[model samples]
Target: MSDTRRRPRHVGAKLLLLILVCYFLVPVWWLVVASTKNAEGLFAGDGALWFSGFHLADNLRHLITINNGEYLRWLGNSLLYASAGGIGCTIVSVLAGYGFAKFDFRGRNIVFAMVLGSVMVPLTALVIPTFVMMSNAGLTDTIWAVILPSLLSPFAVYLMRVYAAASVPDELLDAARIDGAGELRTFVRVALPLMRPGVVTVLLLSVVSTWNNYFLPLTMLSSSKLYPLTVGLGLWTQLASSNNGGGESLWNLIITGSLVSIVPLVIAFLTLQKYWQSGLAAGSVK
Candidate 1:
């Protein structure tokens, strides 16, 4: 009787998991199929989720060669923004989180409370104010307008704080201090090594956020050359749907560019997966 009940529960869980997997994967499958089709095949294809033709090479070639390689410039811009913002944000989050977790000082709780509160605020809401500030500073339409803003992530900092507190021990830190290690040495040699997983996690989050960020960059930058893939693709989508000029011909290129845009993010996650897993294992052992 107990075995019968457990078997049914297990089957139900598997069914639910399968549903979730399909829900997430189906769209990706559609995008993959769509990228291989031409303008004609995209609308009147065999099926939306099935390949209609193998025009992927043509689509990719067009994607790179169009408008004097504007797509490639967008790709390079995205890489630059994501790399700079991710690394900078990760460094800031790690240091700030380590301090918040380990340090004792006046008004620490109050300051942290503000940081926590900021996380509750929608990022879109801040875009206008941030844009205004950038405009005032005469930095609008420049790379700094995007990269500088991407550096501060309240949730990343909060996540890092929680990870540092749980993963790094006060006793261990005290021992490091007692061993004549300076604060910087202790952080670099002792605390940081233990927080590897959290650092990687923050790095991935910041990179993905900056890479996919559309509204912020849109509001801050007016130049097409500085546009990231998100904004660039969004522009293509607008043009393709507007029913004006040669916009309709860009549909296939849009789909192909999107597929290309995601490759870096996939590579980043796969490359960092081992470090993330190792960190989790280390945390569990501690």
Candidate 2:
């Protein structure tokens, strides 16, 4: 194609990309702006983007102090769930994926097929059944109810399996074996290091999913003390909606709480983004 003919198309594509970026980012921009304002300013501030106030500290203090600092507890619970689930899920996914990718065990194909099939199953659909099982086993209302289920991520397994198969060389495994390395030793020293990118990706995915999980925690736990950020914020919103004898606007607290709950996920993304991008690039190269 001639340069002149392609110029308009390029300009149009740039414009479309800009539009999509703004469409997705405007809400986040609004949130950052809104979080800085007090209850009155949030509703009264016409310039949601430009308006500023000194209520951020006050709002944060209130959020921390609400119901005797339950917000902090919720945050702690979320951190616990996300950390436990992320680490556990990453380990399980890596081991399972390594086996599937490298081993030649009997029924391997059938087992892989089953795992892939599980990936297609929606987690929401399994929540009730999972809850029933947890309840039967006397695990309900405990952190285990949330952590146990998140430890097994079918999608993570699939990702690890694909990445391992592509990135790990069979020759490397054989070389380690010849050098007097046991299977566990080879896996830990060789395969695991080689699969860093995939492991980081799975870790990020698992943490994010477990951090933002609402339905699972809600269904499994009835104690507010054990509630994660998602469920706690949800309960706050519900209370705000139901009560009217409030001094400060509960709506502001709800909005602020929602904003606070998002901070961890943002931090997790920023921290692990390099690993995910590098891993994906390396996997593609393989």
Candidate 3:
């Protein structure tokens, strides 16, 4: 009788999960299908699910060749900004979080409260002030404009603090101290290994945030040469709208470019998803 009652609930849960997965995957499926079709086929085709033409290779070639290969440049810039900022943010968050978790000092609660408060403040509200500061420092239109701001992820720091407190054992630190290990050495050797899961989580979050950052980069950078994929893609979209009647034929390029831009993000997520999952599980266990 209990097993019969549980079957309906299990079936219902599976159906709900299937619906959610389809909701998320449908747009991605459309993008993949649309990217293989030419402009005419993409707009004229009756079936959006089926590929009208196989222009994936051609579209990719043109994507790389447009504007003397500026798309590739934007891709490279994005990689540099995301990689540098993500790694730096992860390290800073981990160290700061570990310190906050393990050490006791005057005003610690006050300082942590301030950090937590900062998280509630939307980043959009700070754009103008940040732009002004960057302009004053003569950093506008530079990679520093993006990298510097992205490096300070308050939420990542907060996550690290919670993880460090829970995952890192007080006995371990005490043992390291008794072994005459310096604080820095203890952190590098003992704390870091145990904090690997949290570190991976922070790294993944930082990378995704940096990769998708559009508004901040749009506000900071004016030079096309310095643009990341998000900004560059927006520019292409704007130009496509303006040149709708012209023979510039950017529809194919824009769609193809959008598809290309998503590849890196997809690859990064797939590759790091295991690490992220393991990290979360480890932190939960700790």
Enumerate clash totals for all models, in the order shown: 0, 0, 0
Which predicted model would earn the best lDDT? 1
lDDT of model number 3: 0.89
Query: Could you tell me the lDDT of residue 151 within candidate 1?
Result: 93
lDDT of 1 by residue, 37-60 (tens): 988888784689888779999999
Runs of candidate 1 with Cα error greater than 4 angstroms are 277-286
lDDT for 164 (candidate 1): 96
RMSD of each: 1.7, 1.5, 1.5
| Residue range 1-286, candidate 2, lDDT tens digits | 6999999999999999999999999998887778778878887848887656768788888889878999999999999999999999999999999999999999999999999999899999999999999999999999999999999999999999999999899999999999999999999899999999989999998999999899999999999999999999888777767785243477777778888888888888898899989877875644
Candidate closer to the true structure by lDDT (higher is better), 1 or 3: 1
What's each prediction's TM-score?
0.95, 0.96, 0.96
What TM-score does prediction 1 earn? Answer: 0.95
| C-alpha local distance difference test of each model | 0.91, 0.90, 0.89
